[model samples]
Target: MKINKKIACFILSTALIFTPFLVNIHSYAETTSIDNEEDKREQEERERQEEQRRQKERDYYVAVEMYSDFPKLKNDTQNTLTVQIKNTGGSHLEKSKIKVSALPGEISLTGGSSTTQNIGTIYVGNQTSVNYEVQVSKDAKTGTYPITFEFTGNYGTSVENYKAYSYSKTFYLNITKTEKEKDKSQYKPFLIQNIKHPAIINKGDVADLTFSIKNPNDKPMSSIKVSVSPDEGIVNQTQGVFVENNFPANGEKTFNVKLFAQDKAEKKNYSIKLTVEPTNPTEQTDSKSSEDSNETPKILPTSTQYTGIFYNAPDKDEVDGVKNPQIIISSYSYGGTYVEPNQQFPLTMSFVNTSSQKVLRNIKISLSAEEGTFIAVNSSNSFYIDSMSPNSSVTKTINFVTKPDATTKTVAMTIDYTYEDTKGTALTAKDSISIPVMQKTLLSIDDVAQPQDVMEGEPVNISLNFYNLGKTKISNLKMVASGDFTVQGENSYFVGNLEPGKNDSFSISAMPNDPNKISGVIDFTYEKLDGSIETAQKKFNFTLNPISPMPDNNNMDDIQPPKHDNKIIYIGVGIAVVIIIGIILKKRHNKRKKSQELDLDE
Candidate 1:
């Protein structure tokens, strides 16, 4: 009964303690449930707020526009086009794409941005624009060019939200005939108009040039401007002139251009160009086209169609004993012909011209020879012809003379002159004549007055006679002597204009400083009237004797002669006597010595 009471009390105590603990545990569990529910509610509210914010922040909108000039174009004409895109969105549009397409014509996207940022979210009023350029076809018929812009973007759900926006604009492209396509017969023709002058123009001369503008096309022309460009030494009446009316179809316009040539102008032909300009309304039109009826005119050259005359002769050659020759050259007109050296010939040049221009006035011809040669005309003549038309000509005669000592060979003769045509344009012609030179007989130094012996410091006289048996004249004569002698007279003389078979006499005096060392040849050279040179030479010898003194005979008789003669005679005799005595003494001495030796032996 005691153990039962103890157990019951223990059980009651343990139950009492455990009952509070259980209650506290139940309360704690309730608190934990409330916290968990609060946490779940908070999580749900945050998620809802996040979803609402995302829906407000994320949005997509797109637009397109055309950017180009001449968008509303005409048919058969090219036009450039560009399309722009704008994204009216709140959030970045991912995988967003825009495509520009055209109907009926070729289209291309001139490079532009295709990026998420490029098509990104736009704050309410913010916009993004892209450009796509396209070229319209030239041959497209009259129609509307529909350009469509399509934009593709994304929305919230995993499934792609596609909001497609498209807009199109029509270009009223009309086909009309262009200016180039108008009446083909309205095309203008090509023309050439040119002017030419004489080869040699005198100063202060009024020269005329013919201007012909040829129409090469089949159409009639009008409203033309003809312009002239005159260089230095030339003056034109006007810079340009206009023809008010129309030109006949396939016809030429003829006019005369007067060039007031200045005296300062050199002696050569001058060239000028005539330009023609046609009138047109469109400034962009090609002036060279047939439609530009007022096109530049063409220049017709008459000189190219005409043939000029030429003359020539042979050149001269250097030779001995040759007389100067004569050559003649005649020309109907002017050209590049020139005379060569030592040439002998009569030449006539032919002239021709395709145009009907008449050459009037006398052609004044002049002749000139080389420096060493001479030219003489018969009566100082000048060539003259009444009148020469195109392709017609006449000849004039000329004469050239050569000197006696002139080099014999072909020589050149140049003939130059000027004439005026009916148009007042001065023309020139040149010709050459070759003349042959004949060989002339030359006179040598047949005799000379020279001394064979000469004393030092004595003057010696030398005389020479020169004769020319040739047909030409002689001039500019000179003579010189080389030695130990000083020339006291004139060393050079001018024998002007010696005729054929003429002789020139001259004297020279020389004083030699040292006659012993003197000996050499004398050279003579002279100029002949026919532009030639002659040379001759001669040799001389001289001797000089040395001086001596006379002897004296006054003191010859005052000197003695006997003593020296006798002394010489005695000396010779003594020498012979001494030789004989020596021989006799030698014999005696030998006998005595022999006697003495014999006595000693006994």
Candidate 2:
């Protein structure tokens, strides 16, 4: 019995000790299994996050917002529009393009800018914007119109090359009917009916002139002042001043103008300009006289010149009542029937004598110019016409040139002739003619091609297109570039000529040295028909992107050159020279010792 109990106790003790050890082993195994499961979960989470990041990189998202000035667009009216684009993607985009499309039939776009625009580069979470001016047709219907905007571009995270992406969005616009209004200041209140003057007046004579003025507006104008003045050749008798107190509405008033003709006044048509103004226009009284001499007048100036005549009037024969000389211009023409400013052109004048009893003799035609503005190029100032029979006609040719800066203007000229009448009376008759000068040609620059990416320290080619936007031809056109950059190629390009509405292009290579806002001007010079030069300029601006620096990767083993020791080298050279002198002296001393020993032996 005792033995069985001992055995039981020993087995129980062993079981207790071993049972804890087995439990520990089981707990260890369980912990390893749990750790492995946690590692697997963590790995799956990392892979999922990588996949999500890759998906985001491949996606391109953009948020768009449109703004306009009017809530409803009106026909025949101009409106401003703004477009805002926000990048919501994970990559950077470059060279983005946007254009307005899918417009309704009632809509049209016109402005100084183009319809399509380049939005440049947009980084992730950044935005870009554009502005445009929109116009609608005058006869557009009132309704809802759809406007589509399309975006096309490439991204930086492409696999092989820049991947192209295209997106389109449509926005609606409400259209309404609206009429454009004109400015009230554009309406004129007065009208000039007729101006009558003597057809012939001699030098140092007073010219009696009559002019009629009518109020064309509904309201009556008071305190009216009239100013009639000559541009050249004559002066006003009363200092070119006239005043009227009240001008009746819808009624005409006639005033007489007296001007003093100068002694040096050539036979020319003078320009008389009339100016009118109203003072105290609202106040009116019936007691005001037709001459309204009580009120102060307002002064206004006319925009253009009025034509008048200056000449020596022909004497009338008392018995026959026949005028001695009568000269009239039958016809006139410029070369090729056209005249341009700065162009020397032939002006042919045909004169007719429409007199019955007068026989013309000793006829000499004299020409005078309006100084500094017009020049007589090829004709004599005093031309002879020989003689003209009664009721006969003759023709003469002269060449004249207008000023280079002359616009569409009338150049005044004088024609004076001396002749003897049939009754042996010497008479002088003067007449004037105006030549119309037109602007020949104008050069305009458009479609200038600047580099899309103007980077600092890089060469870029720039091109400019020139067009002859005028009615005539432009000659000797040249272009030169200036500002901010060094011209890599030829600085100037010579284009021979450009016809009306013709186009030509020139190119130049340039490089910017510094990172700054690069601005430049292209100077365009052209020649007119009369060999005069004119200049026009077009301006351009762009930002220069700086070049990226190379990364630094250095190592310690790169041996540097030995430091120069000029002082040590100089000292070593001096020591070597001294040792050579000492060796020569020692050799001479030993030779002398040998010579002394030989003498002792002798």
What's model 1's lDDT at 452?
Answer: 39
Best by lDDT: 2
lDDT of each: 0.48, 0.65
TM-score of each: 0.24, 0.32
Q: Give me the displacement of residue 424 in model 2, in angstroms.
A: 10
TM-score of 1: 0.24
* RMSD versus native structure for model 2: 28.1
Backbone clashes, candidate 1:
60
Alpha carbon deviation, residue 422, candidate 2 (Å): 8.0
Model 2 collision count: 1
Off by over 4 Å in 1: 1-348, 353-450, 453-457, 480-482, 488-497, 520-527, 530-602
Q: What tens-digit string does per-residue lDDT give for candidate 2 at 1-602?
A: 64456545655665676677557655765675666677668667866866654454355443333333234566688877677777766667788888886767777777666768999888878887777777888876544455787777777455455766566665556554453233333224466657878654665678787877776655455556667878666787764666666556577887777886676665555677876655434433322443666644322323233756645433445437876666666566777634676778777888877565677877878777555456678656567876788768898887877767665556677778777776767777776777667676677788556565544454555666667888667877777778787765356666667778887666555666455556788898888865679998888787656655444222112344454444455456556755765575566556766776898899
